[model samples]
Target: MKSNLAYLHSYKQRLAFISVSVAIIALSIYFNFFQKTENPEFSKLTFSETKTEILPLNIAKFNPNTLSTEEWKALGFSEKQVATILKYKEIVGGAFTSKNQLKKCYAISEEKFSQLEAYILLTDEAGKKQNFKQNKWVKKELIISGKFNPDLYSEADWVKMGFSERQAAGILKYKNYLGGSFVSKEKFKECYMINEENYAKMSPFLLLPSKTPADFNPYKKNYAKEKRIIKYQNFDPNLLDFEAWKKLGFSDKQVQNILNYKERFLKGSFKTLDDVSRCYMISPEKFEEMKPFIKLNPDNFAVNNVVNSNVEMPKQKTDFAKIDLNKITFQQLKEFGFSDRAAASYLAFRKKLGGFSTKDQILKTYNIDKELTQKLIQMSTLSPLIAEK
Candidate 1:
């Protein structure tokens, strides 16, 4: 009986050992060949890149004042730029009439102005209004045959030669803007409205002198000399009528600009010599010649009319006697009797500088007159304050 029990136990132990060995073999086979495994090089895979292309502008001739928002976009103006144009027009009462005026818009860049300059056109009414003229610019039927001198041609002459009223006026205005004569036909081509085709057509009729005088200076001094002796003895720009301004060597366009500048500011009047020079139409040499004759009251001139602008003149008391120009704030500048344009300019100038080191540097401020500089020096002490301090 003992031998039989021992035999049974030995058989059962062998069977259990075989079952454990078969289970180990199956697990090893499954792990080695059938179970799923992750890829090691997955992170190193590359993808095709996508690229963007810039589209060229589709430009066309259109009046900027009347150009729709869509038209402005087609002409390459961004939405922000288009909004700026509309806002500017709304503030200024109408569209731009001249390249100089257009450039004065804060949003318009020099490059953008140059690109769109050729397409700008002022309506007849707008042109006449800006030129300060009441007479209709065009008076005759079309007759496009003539060899005419630009300097000598009248509006009637221009109209007879196929130029529109606005084009004729722009040519005349450009000539006068040069103070009455162009130095060369090439100079005449600089007119914004004078395209290559118009220039080519008018080149044959240009009356440029065959020989420039040996002493001929291109500064327009010779042309200015031919005008009636400047009768502006101690004239006040603040009180002068439009005709009186014209008598002071200001062209019609220039007179309009002066009046516009005066009306655009709070006081709407010239406070210093630098103010006169700020007008784009007035050259430095011209300003110097007229400086001694300029007269302004010690008190600010009161203008009845005020053209609206975006810059809000904050009411702040800035005692010039206690102010430092190098450390002046934008609001303080306005309080110091600077126009909004001039005040903004001062802030920009100071931001670019590492503080002012000398009294002479104050003159470098935009539209700051020598008289104003002298006043500032008397009123406030010039300190050597560095930017970091």
Candidate 2:
């Protein structure tokens, strides 16, 4: 009876072992082949072939004007299809004038257009007309029917000539910086606030000379024979008074003009040597002569100050603590001396990437400079938790 019991226990152990082995084999087969084959996307396709497969579409109401490149792709459009739509919009002017215009694109077939028709939103005709009128490039009717000197036109006068209040103020401000008058039509045209179309319409009525006189030397009292004596010494252009500028060979009028520019246009200080160089009254030759003597304070040479300036300034040395790239804020970036535009751009790119996994990825941000890139790399740290995700 004891022998019979022993044999039964031994047979049960062997059966149990075989059952476990079979279960393991079945699981391995499922994982290695059956599991992958169950999903059509993973089955029987090369990498290149998989890439050609269409991504699922997400349809929603969208304005073509505000829709981004990625948003277009999300709406079931192929890369070529998205590019064609964008190109058509660009060719016709920067935006689609109407929903019908977008529907007419070659990439957008009638069937596709039908699918998107209910979701398309565009500006009304009245709104478009208002936008067209507000465009600076659009030619306005001539309010001043006869010849008039733009130099003498007051802010109100400029408004009467069809310029907006803001544009009129800009013109007047620029005119004040140029010694209360425009020397020539070409110089007047150089105002950044005025577009080519507006200038062309106003050109025929402007009474100023078409070009400045070759002999007209703005820095000197007499261009014929008088040579003003100048004393050169190390000086900060930002700190110079009217007397100091006159002492540096500038005429009294030129000195007053420079002071006016420094106080008004530059908000009472020169941020860079380039700002001093750009004074409208300072002739190029005069600036070159005094360039060596100008010394700006070292503290004024911040990264933001020199980014747009032609003058090169050394970046201030800083030891930044490592920061998680995924968690950095726009205000934090601004504290590092980034412009509003650059900071916004960095944030937008980071959002598009989900989150950065490495320091090198920050380099791909639009408008980021090499110096900023190096600083970013030095200060970046990826969160381990984020990396796993």
Candidate 3:
């Protein structure tokens, strides 16, 4: 009987423990299941509601690079404008640091930048802020030597100087290169033809529109000869249209002269009535003089053939330039002998973060197979100038 009581007491103790566990679990459920959910400290809002309430006229004060395409459209930017900015970024480097610096951006308008200045973050990789800055100084002038022709100059008095004809002609030619009509005093000193002595002598009251004579052309006509026609006549000069010149009793030499002059002097046949009227033969002064006699039977006009004669075959640039792996496009990566799959992997890895800055920067982007990165390190691409022109 004593043993039976001991066993029964142990059994009751075990049951009580199990009962207590169940009661604790039931109370936990009652508190948790019946309780109200707590409110979150902050909540996300829909873009439309946020824009309507938050934007106001201050929409102009945002940074465009950070905006979504929808947000860009809200500010009156077209898809093309956005695309231009992206393409310019790819070609010329990335976005401007601030709204004012956005002047370097190709397509964003002044009005649009004003609208977008408010939202710009202008942060670098380290999270440091950026601001607008400009370089205000002018570039220093350059000096170069060249040759020229004197008859091309407006004035003839330049011949009085003891300078060689070639030297004077070269000075004039240099002026032409700069798009200046006449030689500059500052430029003359730049060429060193006018030393301190000559510069002092010539710097006083200048008389220009002075004539500088041209070298006699071996090709120029002898105006003294009857064979040398002093003036041109209004006429069609095609050998194909000999009858037209013959009707005016034009000599064979005269006709030959006219045809040769047409080939040598004109760029092309009449593109329009105005173009035909510009020709020396058909010029306004001459066209009006010859309008009564002018005739046109040929339906087809000649194209500008002189351009073909003068065209220099472009020297084929050697493809000696190496591609920079860090900066290269996916297409460029493939060109460097990366298989399409490997190239695609590199792009995907870079796209997740930003692109690599150096060949070593590739290691920071995840999922790049270690073996592949190691293999790429064995070789490197160089800039075009570094490899060859």
TM-score top scorer = 1
Query: What overall lDDT, based on C-alpha atoms, would model 1 receive against the true structure?
Result: 0.62
TM-score of each: 0.27, 0.24, 0.18
Report the CA-based lDDT of candidate 3 relative to the real structure. 0.45
- Which residue ranges in model 1 land beyond 4 Å of their true spot? 1-228, 303-389
Q: On residues 1-389, what C-alpha lDDT tens digit does candidate 1 reach at each position?
A: 99999999999999999999999999998776555345445557789875432334555555565567887777667899889987887776554544566777877777777766776653232333333258644432223233556787655456556677577778777777765777676677788867775565455446686444566454456445644586547866667777777777778756755565455432565777777776545767678778888877745455354322422222334455566767777766554445576676666766677777887777667544444455555667666655433
**Order of quality (lDDT):** 2, 1, 3
Ranking by TM-score: 1, 2, 3
**TM-score head-to-head 1 vs 3, winner:** 1
Cα error, residue 305 of model 2, in Å, equals 24
Predict model 2's lDDT versus the native: 0.66
Q: Note the clash tally of each candidate.
A: 1, 0, 23
